[model samples]
Structures are given as C-alpha cells and as structure tokens.
Target chain A: MSAKKTEYGEDQDLLMKKSDRRTFLKGCSVAAAAASAALTSGCIPSVAAENSEEMKLRWQEFFKKNYRLMTQEEKDATVARLERLAKLRDGLDVQMGSYPPLKGVLYGYGFNITRCEGFMECVAACVKENNLDRKTNTQYIRIFEMEPGKLDPGTGDGQYYHKVPVENKFYMGTQCFHCENAPCTKACPTKATWREPDGIVVVDYDWCIGCRYCQAACPYYGRRFNWGKPEIPRQEINLRQHYLGNRVRPKGKMEKCTFCIQRTRKGRLPACVEACPTGARVFGNLLDPDSEIRYVLKHKKVFRMKEELGTDPKFWYFID
Target chain B: MQLFLTGLILLVGITTLFWGRARASESSFLDEVKKSTARFDNRSVPLVKEVTEDTVLSHEKYQGGSFRVLARKKNIERYQCSNCHNDKPVTVNRGAELTHGDIVLNHGSAERGLVCIDCHSPEQRDYLEDKKGRKIDFDHSYDLCGQCHFRQKRDWIGGAHGKRVVNWAGDRVVYNCTTCHDPHSPRFEKRFPATYSVPLD
Candidate 1:
C-alpha cells in the first residue's frame, strides 16, 4: 500500500502504520472467513462484506487526525463529516464551525455574590446553550449558596437549598474559569484540552482520549466525562455550535464550558450572562478598561476561588 | 301659569347645580358618557391624556453612555395604570384605602417619609415625578430611583449594579432599575430558583 506524506511527517508515518495494520487485519479476517467456509457446510457470512454508509463514517471517524494537526482542508472535511454524522444520528441540522478567538480581546467574567439571587436561570441557560447531556444531567455552572459571612466554598452548600437568596446567605457560582495557567491542559495526555488566545479553555472532543486526567487535575472540578452518548432530545439541541465549544460531544470525551465561544467570538454575551435576571453575572473583555468586567474588578472587592493555587482564573466573584 | 313656569325654571337650575357638583366630585359621568358613546363609535378614546403638540417631549438621546438603558414602559407587567386613572383626578388623601391596593409602598415609607406622589406623578399616574417636579416617563425610572439610591445608581452607571443584556461588545443595553425591583416594594424576595442545584457527590 502506498502512503502519502504530509507536513506532519511523524503523524503521517503513524497514520500509515495504522492503515497498514488495518489492511493486515482485513487480510487475516478474509483468510479466516475462507478457512471457516471450507470447514462449514454453508458459506460463512463475512462481517466486512456489509459495507454501509454508517460503517464508512465510523472508519473515517476512527482515522480522523487530531484537531491541532489537521490542515485547513482537513478541518473543513472533518466539520462536514461531523455535521453529516449529527444529521444521520439525531436528525439535527447543526451548523458547527471552528471560530477563532477575536483579536485584541481576552474574555473575562465577574460574578456579583451580592447580586446573584441563587436563581439558577444562568445554569438552565447554560445547559440549553451548550447542549449538555441531559441523561447524565451534565451542568457546567454550579451555584453554591454559602452561609452568611463565610467565603469558603468548602462550607458552601451546592445542594439541598430549598429556597434561594436565603436570609443572610449569599450565592457564588463556579465554572471553567479559563485559567491563564490552566492545569487541565497540562494534565491532558492527548493535548486535546487547551486555552485559546482569548483565554477560553476548550476541549477538542474528537481528540480527547477520555483518560479523565484533566478531570482529576482540575481544582475547580470543571471538566466532565461523557460516560455514555450525550442523550440530548432532538428538538432541544442548540444548532449554533463552536467546534471547540458546545458542539454535540461524543461518548467518552471530556467537556467543559467554553464561555459560549460561538456567541462570544462574534461579540455576543455568554448564555449565562444574558439569562441572569439579577445582572449578577458580568462578562466582557479584560483588555478593555471601559468594559463592565474591568469596572467590577476595579471598584468591587473581587476574589477568585482557590486563589492560592495561582491558576490565575479569569473568573472573579465580587461583593457590593 | 306664571308660577308654574318660575317653579319649573328654579327646579331646573337646582338640578343643574346638583349635576355639576356630582360631575366635579366623581368624574364617572364623563366615563359613563364615554362608555355609552364607545358602543356606537368604534374608535376608543386614548387612555393617556394627550400631551399638547407644544408640550410634547422626547426622551433625551443617551449619547456616549456606557450602556443603553432599556425603556421600562415596554417591560412593566400589567401596565395599564392610565386605564382607570386617566379621567379620575388622584385624591391627595384616599384614607389608606389605596386605589392600587395591592401595591405595598414599603420601600421609602418607613425611612424617607415618602408617599405615592413623592415618586409617582399625581397628575400622570403612568409616569413618574422627579425631584425637580418634571414629568418623567416610566422608561426614565432610574432618575426617580437615583434620587435616593445614589450609590446604587452610580454603581449601575459604572456597570457594577443591574443587568446588562444582549451582546457584551458594542452598544450595551441594560435593564432599568424597575425592571428587576418593584418600585412599590423594592426588595428582592426569596423564592425557588428556576432550576435546583446539581448535587456534587
């Protein structure tokens, strides 16, 4: 079998080796089928003989290269194939595009602990916006209602709060802070999860090896592993997707919040920020001094969760 | 015949005086006339008093503000204050049997010695009244709210208080103060959130 060489010679060699192994397996399977046919009275059915569109798609998916290594043409082809796969599997006409980070903008978020009414509007909006797995009940943003005068998240109760904005209690929300010094990216063996130029930590779903190392390494418990196929209802699926963001995640992949990359990259606010009724959530460019996030940082008493770790999280919680 | 004519004229004059007093006290006669005429005339009378062509005012264009504040009139729930109050002159002393009986003015009554007319315009029930006694639209409620909550108003202007909507970049459109807080009862009440917290095991 002839092998084609690309710019990534090492990756090309690996691909060639994989193809060679696959051909060898195919030959072995054929030989095994012949031997079985000779032994049996009737002709044995060959598994490889039934080549369907789905089978071809599965093969293409298996051979798909890492997102980082993919050429522009390869990326486009992969996006097309993924779109086709989504349509075939879920009947969703999803528009998946890889949006590059905006120039001269580093996205940062601020949460007013005083203003957050413990209303999970942001959480609900996030689940819908990101197309998170409904079966696993996957959520990126977790609002913890803390006791009065206590700032520690360790003592905060995320669950079992009957009523929100409980007297003397304040709410603090946590998500992927998109740390400037992200530990998850360091822990990722496949280099699937990394921070973009605009400071959003994103996971290339196809590239993730489902090792859960990132999950363990993350101090904020930001990453989520898809144990099974993300069971999203067909009608509820968000068609607007970023390739590295809220795109329909496959099973056994790690996923996290990308700050609504599809929306934010286009100068729109994140779903959580828009959904917040109390204006508790603030998001804007950290670079722009005139931006709301900058104003909050400058005026309010802002603190990050696990600040001692020195992850340098872009997300900050402030009190009026 | 002369006595009968004089008695009839005197009786008619007394009746007219009584009718005028009744109309003045309770302007329901005009409402009744309107209701009766409305059946025949399909065109409904305007609920809000028509601002004369000369006195008509437009909201000052917010130029170079950090964010574009949304008009409150669009967002007010069950906003038909003028429906009942248009023809009726608001009595200064309604004797605690409030017209807006549901509205509990707990915000400024205890601390600031404020009444309904303090913020809300007595003449225009739909619009708010500012410290300068200028008629303010419901859209510009921040002006009225800013009178007392100056710190919060400053924070809002500076982007620390209130919610911003739509795109974060470019023209920011923020919710007005009255959008989240009820002017009658400004405190945010404790209630069940939209979704429950996912238990972190």
Candidate 2:
C-alpha cells in the first residue's frame, strides 16, 4: 500500500506520515513552552496562560490521532477531553465511550410497512437521541408516505402528509442502510468513513474533510453534511454517546445513522426502535436464527430499497 | 374498648387467611400454565421454509417463541369489573341501561356479531372465556385472542406480529394485544404524527 505512487511522484503514505509527525511534535513543543512560561511569569500572564485549558484542548483536538489508530490510553484521554469540552462549551456533562461489536452478532433491521401508521415517533426519538442540529432540524430518519400499492420512495411525500395512516397510504422510513457494499465509504477521499466489523457504516467525524463526495455517492441520500454548527441546547443534550455514532459533531463534518452504535453494542435496543408505538420497526442480530429480524425475512414478503444497484443493504421492508 | 380491639384482630386474621389462600391458588394456576407453555414451545413444527446456508451459516440456535407478553389489566381504566357486578350476574341484554356506556363495542360486536359473553366469562366477570369455556387469566389473554385470529396468533408466537421491548439480545419480552388496542374498539385511531423533519432537498 505504501509503495504506490501518485501524480505528485512521491509515496503518498510516507509523505502523509512524515507531515503528521512533524506537526504533532511542533504542537507538543509549543504547548510545553507555553506551560513553562505560564509557570515562570507570575506578573505578566501570556495569552496562553489566560485560556490555557481552551488552547490545550484546541491543540489536542487538532493533533488527535484517528480513532482507528488510537491506543487505549489515547482513546480514554480523547474521551475525557471531549467530555470536558462539552461541559465548557454547552455546560453539558456528556458521557462518551467506545464499544466494540459483539462477537458473532451482525445487526439487521426490518421495517413492517403494513403496521407503520406514519406516527413519526421514531423520527422525533432519533433527533433527541442523536443530538441533531435543532436550528436546521437535522434528522437521520425520514418517514415517507407513499401512495397505496406503490413501493417507490422517490414519489413519496415526506413533509406534506397529514392525518396519516390514511385509508390507502402506507409509510416507509429511510436512514443509513449500512450496506455491505457501501458506495459512500468508497467515495470518501480520506477513507474517514468505513463499514465496521458488525456491518455498521460509521464516519470518523474528525477525519472527514467535508468534501460531500459521500453524500453524492449515496443513492439513498443517507449522509448529512453539517452546514453550520449544530444547535443543541445544553439541557437537551443526550449525555450518553459513542465515539463513532452519536457524539456531538462539529461544523463541516459528515454524519449518518450508525444504528445507535452506543446503545446496540451495549446490548440495548436503539431509541427509535423503542419509541415506535406501532411496532413497525424490528432490530436484532442477523446471526441469531430466532431473532425477530430473521423471522421476518424468512416468513414475510421482504424487499430492499434498491436491489438493482446491488448495495446489499442490511435493511429490509416487509408487509403482513 | 376491649371488645372493639378483639373484633379488629379477628377481622384482620380472617382477611389474612383469605388473602393467603387466594395467592396460593393463583400461583399454582400460573405454574401449570408455565409448564404447559414450556412443553408446547419445545415441540418443533415444520420450518416455514428450508434454512439455506446463507440464512443459517453463522446463525445461533433458534431459541424464540417463549417470551412473556405485557399484561394490561393494571393499565385499564376502572379495572375491577367485580366492583360493580359483585352480587348480580352481568346479563347480555342490558343494552340501553348498560353501565359501560363509555365502551363503544366497535370491535367484533359490530362486525362479527359478537356479544360480551363471546369473550368475557359470565361465570367469572374478571376472567376471559375461550370457546371451550375454560377461564383464562388476564396475563394469558393471547390464548383467548388466538382462538379467532389464528394467523395473527401464529405470527405473534413466531415473533413477527407485536413489539419486542427492552434488550434485543436475551429473552424477548413483548407487548400484549390490549397494550396497543382497546378491547371494545380494536381499531387504531388516526391522529397527527410527531414533529416533521425539514425536507433535505
């Protein structure tokens, strides 16, 4: 992988590593010098001395290693720093943790089209759970009310439908499908987004360059790009977070649904699944034969959104 | 004062005796139901379809169909039917003067020509009755429901019909029929949904 040459006529991997190391060392030395100067100069405080914590946090944020490359200690330090920053900025005492996927468990979701009443309870729960930008009304889940007997989501109306569960209309929801052959991951210029071992497509928010390539590549309109800083009220912030899932994202980053990685990896159901009053959503391990998802796939008439595209979405829609 | 105290003690003793007896009978009945369900769950029926390698390669053992459904007796408004029908038996013909005016009876009553005795046991106001006249506890109302809606009952047992609550990993716990549907009027009412998401386009 390192031997490959690019248009620049240099080993891109080597060049990138060298530049990263140089910047990291430079930042460390500067922070050290500033700390010592602050300790020594008691009378005339430097600018770094006044906002040392903030400055250190910024430096650390800039120099933080990629989540996949971070050691255990580094991950812990990063989590602690993020928690502190959340507190400082929004007065939120957020708890962030990284949970690995369970062994022999591949998560899958089934949507019962016949049962969904277009309640949109899942949408509201998702917004609160994922800490989406309220000002822009950023949402990961969209419930599309389609004409009866039609399966095309493109023609469905997401906004105008009222008095839902109408006589002939059926509701279908869309989110990140976490496809096995995810095109969004391939479209990423920086390789910041990839499918996890448990088949959840996740994005490293820090590593995303905000190119919006993944957004264009996605056929289902799964990814959402932050146009501005997310407006999450301090009191409304969900403290429980995962590094790759619902952790508070910054401006100019890309994010999508991770099937509630923080909750699912910990053996709990996702907030959306629990919030659906109509029992339209079913989530479980595909590897478990007795799981409700597997049962639906076996017994019900099931179909994926875009089978011709061959994305191999883990999501399935079924009717009674 | 001495006579009053003696009478109070006697009354307490009698109440305790009756309570203990009732609890013992109820628990024994539940145990019997559990045993029967456990046995029934173990009997294997033919697979709905052949399990191919793609479906069952990494699949764990099939350990479903034995979950407890949520009980709705506690959530029912003015639950104790015996409070009103203690001394008198509830007759089916008490139409205009029916005490339960609030109940619309739009479920099977209007469509399938079902009366109160079709489900509720007249012999015991609190217990549900099957076609065979067996009394069913509120917790085991699925048995009563399954008698008529066989397909839905089959799906419910197979973990396809209702909602599973809490953890998705361990034993599946689901909500009962009454949890979502009112017994008198089983149809769900249409209403405005939750907050709308702004159009992304």
Candidate number achieving the greatest TM-score relative to the actual structure? 2
Residue B21 of model 1 has an lDDT of 67
Write down the lDDT of every candidate, Cα atoms only: 0.74, 0.76
Instruction: Tell me the tens digit of each residue's lDDT in model 2 across A198-221.
Output: 778999899899999999999999
TM-score of chain A of each: 0.84, 0.88
Is model 1 an incorrect, acceptable, medium or high docking prediction? incorrect
Model 1 residue B86 lDDT? 77
Write the residue-wise lDDT of candidate 1 on B6-122 in tens digits: 999999999999998664445321132223211111012111122111211223222224345666675555476786677667665763545557667777656676678888888
Model 1 chain A lowest lDDT segment of ten: A1-10
Write one digit per residue (lDDT tens) for candidate 1, span A1-320: 01111322554465566656766776776566556544542443354343244455665666666676567887888888888887776677989887566665678899998888788989899999999888768889888888888887768888745766777888888889888767898787877777676778888888798999999999998877888777778788899887888888888899888999888877778999989988889997776656677778778999988877767788889989
Root-mean-square deviation of every model: 27.5, 22.5
